[model samples]
Target chain A: MKKTVYRIYTSIIFLFLYAPIGTLMVLSFNSSKTRAKWGGFTLKWYSELFQNDAIMKALWNTLAIAFLSAVFASIIGTIACIAMTGMKKKWRSVLLGITNIPMLNADIVTGISLMLLFLTFGFKFGFLTILLSHITFNIPFVILSVMPRMQGLNPSTYEAALDLGAGPVQAFFKVVFPDILPGVLTGFLMAFTMSLDDFIITHFTKGAGVDTLSTKIYTEVKKGIKPEMYALSTLIFIAVILLLLLANSRSKIKSVKTAERGKS
Target chain B: MNKKMLSLPYLFWSIAFILIPLGMIFFYGFTDKTGAFTLENILAISQAEHMKALWLSILLSLISTIICLALAYPLGLILTSMEVNQNGFIIVLFILPMWMNFLLRTLAWQTLLEKTGVINGILSFLHLPSLNIINTPYAIVLGMVYNFLPFMVLPIYNSLAKIDRNVINAAKDLGAGNLYILKRIILPLSFPGIVSGITMVFVPALTTFVISTLLGGSKILLIGNVIEQEFTQASNWYLGSGLSIVLMVFIIINMVLSAIFDKDGEGGLL
Candidate 1:
């Protein structure tokens, strides 16, 4: 009896969670533009989604910003992690606390503050400003992701490489880099995801003419329920589902292998 | 020795991008358009409209955070108690929605809750009275809860999953009943996750302009909406920055609370 209640409750929560995504998927195929009526089942919106120049531009912008910012953040954050190994605990903690400021503060404040920075500096508000803001907000995620791996590093291995006459850069790439690579990759992915989903900061920093998918959708909603927007979201939803499933299965397989190794 | 110089680039970046921008906010917050220092901008929060918006933002976000906690706690309990493999599947399901652009998801709710939208359509088919709450504060709360629920869930689950089963078993082996074990054993141990989760939900919900704009019609204003307008529409940078300072106070308080509770940083997103 108790189990049944839990099951029903879980289902209800899942229903609430998926209902919006399901609506978007269903609406993507509806021939009618309005949600009030279904004109008929149609695939026109998906096709239209590709051909739409404005949205295509926004998509390109989104990808570029996400990729560039993630790459930049990873570089800076990884370097910061490396340098921290040689620093005192006090300064490292202070720097880390500074890093958390962006993550903890409200997005609107970060957004507006960056905007304010651009205005005060007389910097042109365009793609670069948005890119800068993304990198700023994205660094903390990369740092947090990489810090643990950095902390756990076997410094002796790097010293061993150094003692064997491998140069500093060469030693790091040979020993330390390989060890911390996983964390850096994770940080890069996290940064990428955050930049891609970002709307508020982008909305503020993106001045006239530039638009990401989020900003475009915001403007699109004010005009009407464009079925094309739903189509875009559906594609993204499906892509995320597939990628996560792939990642999940791979991890599961790895775990199974580890368990078997333990038994053997 | 020179390896320490590797962080110089980041140090410069932080000073330029992070530190300077923050200083600019203070500069703007305390100055007028003429750039002279003044108390008027910071004091503007006491105006009836701004105060109303601030209170409304606080009230609605509070409601949303509480609802998210109420919903997520049981779900976390269920997830943590499940077989380890099964935990991943449900978590993936929960996380999938977060990948979809949130603005779009919140907009989807606008369709689902509209007068002629899906829910109303279903109600009419069942011979039930149609419900309408779109473009209201209720709709905004719904948006907050829908968008931020995952933030509440993930941290709580992580922390709960970290609890040693032996501790619970020991409690059970003692004279404690199930409810007592939950209250005494699980709750205290899971406080970090709960605190982090609350901070995660509350900060975004409190500072959200997008959710409110998408759901609550223009007539409804949250502090976020007011600050956004002050910058974007009114072009009053001083007023916008000043109001943001007020928002920052609340955010810092939330952060300090989480910092206190999650001292070991067990459940912290950082």
Candidate 2:
């Protein structure tokens, strides 16, 4: 009886959590001008969204920024993870704590400070500035994601590789690299998602005439919630769900393979 | 050892990209408009009203964090107990909103909370009077909770998933009640997750401006809003930097205090 009650309560909580999101998805196709009224469904908003040049440009900019930031963050973060793993544990902890500051700090503050820094540096607000700032936050995320997997590796694997006549680079690439690939990929995807979703940092750093989807969404909602924004959101949500399913299945496959290896 | 080769790139990037920019932000906090760095800007930020706003941000974040933890603890319990397939589905459902645009999610709440919005529409349909929910602190809390609930849930779930089932079974065999086991065994063991969740939710909630701006209206002010006003509105980058520094200090203090309270420090050890 108690277990059933618990299950029912969990469902209710989940409903509360998902209701607004599910509602937004449903209402994206609502033919009514007002969000409240449930008029007949129509596919007009999505088609309208595609035709808007401004939205298209913004979406492109968002993708570009997300890609650039994720790639840069992945490189820096992988290097940092490699370096940190060799340090004394205490120093490693301190380094990690420092890296995590950007993640924990208020986005508004970070955004403003970065803006101020750009002004002080006499740099223009555009692709480079936004990319640099995004990378700052992204690197920490990547590091956090990658560090665990790095630590989880068997220490003697590298030793065995070296003893087998492999040079340092060869040993790292041949042995260590393959083990932490999942962590690296996870970090890359996380950074990509973060860059895609960020508004606060991008808002402050973006130059004139450069509108990312987040900034565009901010402006549109500030004016009024439009169906086009909802349509865009629905599409973005679907894309994320698809990516998540792919990542989940891929990891499961890897897990099963690992289990089989353990059995052998 | 590849330490020397690796250290070069790590040090170069950290100094050039991370340390320099951070130093510039801190340096600018001390500089006035005359191109000279001064302490005047720091003093200006210490005014009474700014202090109140700082306190308010902390208090509001604390309240929201508490409420989120309340919701998350039970939710985490249920999630951790589920089969892996079901757990994965629940996680997707939970984390999906986090992937959606933050501004849009907050806007969704605004649409739902307004007089003609979904909540009020439901209320009126149920023969109840519509109540004002937007442009208030409550709205800000709602927005924060909505935006960050997953951050709280995920960490707790991660910790609970790692628990040894034999510990619970042993407690059960020893005649411990379910409530006692949860309190003394599960909750104690999950302290790190609780800590991470608190930091994840509380830190962001403390500094959220977009949610407050969209939902809390002009009446509601957080430190984030004040920081924005200083730089963009007031054109006082110095003062804004000071506020940012103060906010950073407060965050450090919060982390330390949480660590201390964690006793084992697992909550804050990270």
Candidate 3:
């Protein structure tokens, strides 16, 4: 009886969670533009999604920004983490505190502040400004993810590489890089997702004619949303599901291997 | 190698992008359009319309945060009690919606709650009462809770899953009942997660303009809407910056509380 109740409760919550998503997916295929009644199912929206140039441009911008920001944030964040590992405790904490500012502050404040900064400096609010703002926010996520691995790093192995006559860069690549690879990968993925999901910050920072998928969606809100957007979101959702499943299975295999090694 | 030199780029970036930008907000908040010092912008919060918006934002966000907590705590407990592999699968399911565009997700609710929407259509078919809460504060609250529930769940679930089973077993062996153990051990142990979850949900809900705009309609005004209008429509950067600084005070208070409670930062996003 208790188990039954628990299952029922969980199912209800899951229903609440997935209902909107399921509704959107269904609407994506509806032939009618209105939500009041379901029209016969059709694949026209999917084809139309591809043919829409503005949406295609927005999609391209979204992916490009997410990718570039993640890459840049990963490099800068990893370097900062390494530097932090060697810093005095007080200074390291101070840096970490500063890093948390973007993460902890409300997105609106961050958005407006950056907007004010760009306007003050007379920097054009275009793709570059959006990219810069994303990189700024993305860096902290990368650092937070990498910092734990940095803390766990074996200094002896790095010192041994140095003693073996390897140059500093060579020693780092040989010893420290492999050890922190998981953290770096995780950071990069996190940053990518964050950039992709961001809307408010992009809305404030983006200029005229520069539309990410998010800003594009916002513009369409006052006007009725196009059916093409629903189709695009459906594709994006399917893609995310596949990617996460792949990542999940790979992690599962890795854990199984670790367990086997432990037994050995 | 001067290891410190490696951080110089990041240091410069933060100063330029983070610190200076924040300083500009303060500068704008306290200055007039001509750049003369004035407190009028800051004092604008006391005006009737602004005050109403601020209070509405606070009230609605508080309710959403509470509702999120009520829903998530049990969900977290359930997730933690599940087998490890099952736990992972379920969490993935919870996080899946977040991967979709947030605006679209909220917009989906807009469709469902409209008078001729899915829910109402179903209800009328069944001869049940239709939900007419769309374009009201209630709809806005629903949107907030829907969007932020995952943020609340993930942290609480992480903290709860980390609790040592042996400690619970020990408590059981003592004279404590299940309720006693939950109240004393589980609740206190999950305080950090609870604090972080509250902070995460509350701040966004309080500052959200999009959710309110889509669900609350133009009829309801939020502080976020006021600030956004000032920046985008009204082009009153000084007034916008001033209102933002006021909003930042609430955010800072929440952050300080979270920092006090979650010292280990264990409740951070995974």
What's model 1's overall lDDT?
0.89
Model 1 lDDT tens row, A1-264 = 877887898889989998998988888999988876788999999999899999899999999999999999999999999988888899899889889889988999989889989998899999999999999999999999899999998889999999999999899898998888999998999899899999999999998899998888888877876788888878887888788778878988999999999999
lDDT of 3: 0.92
- What CAPRI class is candidate 3? medium
Residue A252, candidate 1: C-alpha displacement in angstroms: 4.1
Of 1 and 2, the candidate ahead on lDDT is 1
Give the distance in Å from residue B141's predicted Cα in candidate 2 to where it truly belongs.
Answer: 0.7
Candidate 2 deviation (Cα RMSD): 3.0
Per-residue accuracy of model 2 over A229-257 as CA lDDT, tens digit each: 78988998898778878878898899999
Each model's DockQ score: 0.77, 0.56, 0.78
Task: For model 2, report DockQ.
Answer: 0.56
The regions of model 3 sitting more than 4 angstroms off are A253-264, B84-87, B261-270
Tell me which of candidates 2 and 3 scores higher on TM-score.
3
* Second chain TM-score, each model: 0.94, 0.91, 0.94
Q: Report how far off residue A249 is in candidate 1 (Å).
A: 3.4
Please report, in order, the local distance difference test score of every candidate based on alpha carbons.
0.89, 0.82, 0.92
Task: Flag the better candidate by DockQ, 1 or 2.
Answer: 1
lDDT by residue (tens digit), candidate 1, B1-270: 696688798888888888899898999999988989998888999999999999999999999999999999999998777555363676677767877888888888988999999999899999999888999999999999999999999888988988899999998888889999988778888888899899999999999999889999889999999999999999989999999998998998888777877875444333
